[model samples]
Target: MFVKLHFEEWIKNEPGVSENTKELIDEAIICYRAQAYRAAYLFSFLSFQNLLKERMLVASCPPGYDEEYWKGIQSELRNDDKWEAKIIECVERERPAQIFNLSVDTKRQYLYWKDRRNDCAHAKSNKIGVSHVESFWLFFESNLSKFGVGGGKEALLEKLKVFLNPAFTPVDSDPTSIIKEIPLTVDSADYLEVIENVYELTTVDIFGPMKTRVWDEMFKLRGEFLDQLVEFIKTNQSLYTQLLKEDPSKVRFFANDPAFIRSLWYEMKMDFRTYKVIIGLLRHNLIPREELNEMISTVSSNNNDTFFFQVEEPDLLVLEESGFFSEFKTLAFVDMKINDFNWARENRNIIWHLIIRNGFDETIVEALNNTMSNSFIPWRLRDSILELFEEFPKLKEEYIDVNSRINGCLPDKLFNSN
Candidate 1:
């Protein structure tokens, strides 16, 4: 039996493929499994040509595609005898900056595959076999990315600015599809530019949906297109550090991903971003579970800087509004050592930071739940913690007694009786 072909990023599933093209791919897959190598090669070769024609049909650009040339190509594609030649014409006529650009050898391979397909179609004795079918699949899979527009990352981002902006973007444009195009457009060198532009758009008034929903696409990037991001991080390591520090929610997609974290674990410097990433992995109950405690301890020593942001009050407000400091406090409270809530007793300043910023969150409530002792409760949070008794049902204050006189929620009595 033929092993299932893996293209990693779903090259076979490119959008806008014609129904005939889709069926052709399916037929090719079936024939390959049946050991009918010639039949598979012919079907796949036809589908590849048809898929290219379809991508050209729908493919438009910023400065725009040539309607006259493309419409002629489209008209020719409707004819049985002329379409294959027209598809090749489109590939050749397209400039180095628009449509798919091919190298001298790659361009030669296109014709080479075409001739091989002719041998199968005309029943010429070229001896088509399993290797031929597999080689065609491999070639098609590797070159799938070259099918997009050609001006490189600059053109890609220019198009993206309009695509992401609700005002400039077409009403029919799908953000998800545009996201998939990011990898298709640029290589690893331009990945950070892509992220920074996307981040800028999130601040646009009409782009609110992009802000919340971008994490979904970012999740996709981290999964299928993670190599682009991994390379981006390798080159711009400090930017990620700053972004993770300035607004963890901004880089939450990367910070929260265990695979992304574990992949870059040793390569990364021990900074606050490292602290945040480790906390994110811990909070989500992700892998390398036993190593996380030691990981936290290692970075925590370097994380003792007084201010989370290295800026003045006014500039700090911007980062604060973006929910940056909250991640720090959240990380600050994550005690991997037996849920030591008493650590808060020593770090009283973080309690003030918590109250002034976002108030008590789940981590606070969770730590309080671990022990019946109110020793972790401080003077400032006394009234507020009591008020939150019923906020989260599962973590309701039923676990802690606020009114008890024995070791009560009073200011002076908030400490351990022992």
Candidate 2:
């Protein structure tokens, strides 16, 4: 009955293990199942040694590889008769550099397995059994992911750039075919750099169209690695602004996870670019209603100004649904935007537009009543704006609850008779 073993099935499915390594391991597993205990031990020991050595030689030495010793290992691996000895020697030479990333415990197990292999190969009296083979198999499974090669970020990027470029890579190419090679080969820091590199392409010529494809594919990175991609988008000032510009389809993914939404919210920067992107992300009702309260909680904690002048009336209405917006907060933000000396008449128009759309309550009306005019816009235009608001019944009250200028600006109304 030709049934596959559990470990054999797992070996086939493990994406981190190289195909060459898996084939080598397959031989060992077959022999062990057949009760060829000595052969199994010999094959198991040699296969792992082969994996480590081959991974070392893949596509040039990555950074942190001991160049001198790497050259020595390269030379020794080429010689058929001495190669196996060189592997054992490499493991023996482990301590000073410990380049394979093996921990103290795994290294100890390797030495123990080597002795067991010697007994099988040298015709020693030591009896080989299922336990010996099983232990070796377990050790192999536990440690295989750690043995990945190409351990340098720069080297990884140098290679990734090649794969990401559409000219060199075929349209039909499964990026996963290349990405599969990336998992253990690259570090988390390398993952972040990869995302940043891809993003820079979007903002430039030649590769702009390809950026989304690359970005969408970047989501393929599993588990903790995916966080790096999100972090890059959330924390980067330019990218924070640019999300509004990214494919709208991505918002579902961006706002998908509660933690991700919270993270994106918390990372919001105090700038128009970040503010616009956050507004865009909040649109289309893509954010789950259940998560809105949490996001509102996030919004309340933010101490920065909302820059609401840029927002439309309907958008403010949308944010209000999530409990993420309040008249008081908008007024405060309105206060800040009104006060910034850099903004001119055009800015004031936008501010008045938002206030009219939301329709002022007593709090907003009173806030406006107490607000004063700034030097940025001429007091006449400010008075015109106030007059426009006052024509509506809600804002008909006389301005200025205080006689003195508020925050060093002139009275909320410079003209009284109108």
Candidate 3:
């Protein structure tokens, strides 16, 4: 069956989209129909790139940057070396923090999609699957509305409409519907029923035992369900508090599910309301600290490299206070790259404590040595290293002598002390 008619129309008529871009989308549809999934992805990616470039070029140029100057920059984007850099520059310039609600993790995901598009275009060994294409499409669709780029809200609503069952309206569209279905008084049975329904949606495999058209629809439904649940909790705060007091596990499902947790973190990374909910749960001992640690472990094991680091600053502090840092330190220092090492150095007290308490593990020592040897390493890290050396005097002389020879002098602290 065709993906969805309204979605196709939405993409076709998306403002600022060119006729040539429409042709690329049409080709993508044709390839998808033929089961040429890779080709379909490539064409869709091309359409997405063209539309993005056009939008960026129009919106991002500085007031003083005349049409001729804009044309010169646009021309440079056609070059292989210049394309990604130019796009990043445009995005940074136009969609600064106030305008774009994207988090560090989301921005990284965007760059990753761009890299995947390059793989598709340049015949890289990386396989382009249906899931990858779906991810790219979903990200673009959501952000289009998020950034308010040319009727994005209407476009998003139209797209969401395609996935929704005609008989059932989205919860956000009809507030009274949820109130009727979910019940006003919060009995245990009602709470359990609501939790069960939301859990099923969160855990459902989109590609298994379901038609392709239902996939996007289910995702939208789950999101709407979450919104309704959050609202219900807010409206009946006393009831939720009572229920949570009786059984915190009811709310723990959000933290327990890695996919759900990551999605929530990314979507509301900037919002305090969600953080309040999580912190409340933590304070009430609803979600065990060990559970949070396990969640981080699970995410790490699943190869989600950035989720933990992307946690908002306040939440990061909460996680640290809850003993998540012990678990974090195990992973952070192992093969620590410069960026991560620097991050650790910023939290030097925690890192130093973990190092000293754990005792001089060879891996950490090696990582420190590597950090010290890099001439470009930040002096803060070097100072931290020297402090670390002071704590473990046995390794101090050896490291000092070696580092001194490498850098031609001791770090200022040691050099001046003498």
Candidate 4:
């Protein structure tokens, strides 16, 4: 809820705060304010569960385990039916002595509040009063430092004062005031710092009207901003590479507008890294379908097969899901060479359905004919072609002559028949 603005960026930026946990806290705050005490208690308890799981994950894993490794642990915890037991097991095995540096009394209070939360969550007829909600808030307030809030309890109370008072004005409300101070022609490093600062200052209200004027202004300056960003990426290769390796989605703000994304795609020289950025944009639907098709067409026409294949290979499902059937067909048939038979066979199941669904039967027939006539085509691939024809009886009529020509031979005897 908008009232609890203090927790917005704090929860989002905390390494221990999973998105699910943040969402639970958001729901809990909304329900608590709405006087839906039972639902509020349940959501708060669920958030506590997530918090414990995150702590366990952090405490159990050694240092230098990358973001992806932590993500895997988080995902496993989410999917595990006995996650509570798993957390307990992790705590016992890992022996995490301290959690956010709470005093013993505060920890006891947290446990007591957790028990009350459980009672209200599990009992259908349990009545949760405002006292219980206030008690939980007290527990939460006492442990503010554990979640990485600075200035200790005084800062927590100060933020709470703003939450409780309607007329309280915060300096962060209009981030544009800060953004405007940064010159349009600032150096790349300074520009990146400004972008990061903007991201940190902006917060989305989960249950209220969207306020994105800061981001809107940034997007309006996409040409200048993206040019600087691309330059920064080029100049600072290691930092940019690290950001991508850790979390490529961090740069998704550039992909929020399709026209800007198209401009970015055109302005930057194509490379493996640029291709990955474009793929991330496409996955996020930041680039329009038509723009994506055009980009793919241009890449293929330029004989940039390596870039084309790199873009299409990992993102075939993304392309299909985005309904880029034309792009999918182009990637499937245009640049694919006979030497890529093993790659084709590896994804034959998905490719087969895609071909049939997109009405590329004629293309497959021609490819099969070419494969059969060309002696340079591997015998194993020749057998694969026959298998494809047999799988689709409708294509049998078209490829019957080619199949007969490659039917019985010394090669057929050497290789197993499909």
TM-score of each: 0.55, 0.43, 0.30, 0.32
Give RMSD to native, each candidate: 9.8, 12.4, 25.8, 18.3
Model 1 / residue 299 / CA error / Å: 11
Q: Rank the candidates by TM-score, best first.
A: 1, 2, 4, 3
| Residue 202 local lDDT, model 2 | 58
The better-scoring model by TM-score among 2 and 3 is 2
lDDT values, one for every candidate: 0.56, 0.59, 0.50, 0.50
Full candidate order by lDDT, most accurate first? 2, 1, 4, 3
What is the number of residue pairs that collide in model 2?
Answer: 0
Position 241, candidate 1: lDDT: 54
Query: Higher TM-score: candidate 3 or 4?
Result: 4
lDDT string for model 3 (1-418, tens) is 5666444666764434579888988898788777777888888777766665655444333334566766787787778677756765654454322223345666677778778877887899999887787677777655543332223223323333432333454423432222222211122223434443333442433222222223222223323344455445434444344333333334553443454434432332322133344444544445445477654444333322122323455555565566655565566566363335445444454454455445544455555566555546656556655677777886565555555555544434433433
Local distance difference test, candidate 3: 0.50
Top TM-score prediction, candidate number: 1
What ranges in model 4 sit over 4 Å off?
A: 1-251, 301-303, 308-314, 323-325, 328-360, 363-418
**Collision pairs in model 1:** none
